[model samples]
Target: MAEKEPPGTTVVIHGGNYGPSSQQVVCPNCHNRVYTVVKAEVSRRTHIIVILLCVFLCWPCALIPYCIDSCKNKNHYCPSCGSYLGTYYN
Candidate 1:
């Protein structure tokens, strides 16, 4: 089920989407700057395993995880208030 937001709350979603670039983005919830990159849909351990596979198993095979949105979606979160902005799907 999808989670619902409370009434009268606004979250600004910018077309300000990008890849894994080192940049600061506007935080809708905090109304200030925040680190844009958040975790992928995959868990931390899963990401580590993927990284290990990319290093050990095969080079090109690493694209499998990198191409998957569940593993690559860049979630944007507010640094000040700890809120979500949006997900950047590559």
Candidate 2:
């Protein structure tokens, strides 16, 4: 038998694909309330433009650092499914 979880405890569950399948971290005390954070996607065009701007503006150091940092820590989440793709520290 599964034990009942206490209220206010966050529970992470695997979300299925389609048909109400969504990852979620729910606070048991809140009765199904879940929380999630999202990150922006960098498109190829945007990447190229950023690179060009770096070169033209003579800010290779700044631009390169930003790109490298962005690439280093990336979190993936499916709001539709509420799944925890991964986490980054630093």
Top candidate (lDDT):
1
TM-score of each: 0.44, 0.27
Q: lDDT by residue for model 1 over 1-90, one digit each (tens)?
A: 978889965444476555554346666566785556566665464577578887796766765775565565576666678777666665
- Lowest lDDT sum, 10 consecutive residues, model 1, at 15-24
lDDT of 2 at 19: 19
Residues 1-89, model 2: lDDT tens digits: 99989997656744322112223555333435454454434445446656777878866553553455453334445454555554432
RMSD of each: 9.2, 11.1
User: Candidate 1's C-alpha lDDT?
Assistant: 0.63
In the predicted model 2, the residue pairs found to clash are: 8-29, 22-81, 22-82, 23-81, 23-82, 23-83, 24-82
Q: Residue 15 CA error for candidate 1 (Å)? A: 3.6
Off by over 4 Å in 1: 1-13, 43-70
What overall lDDT goes with each candidate model?
0.63, 0.48
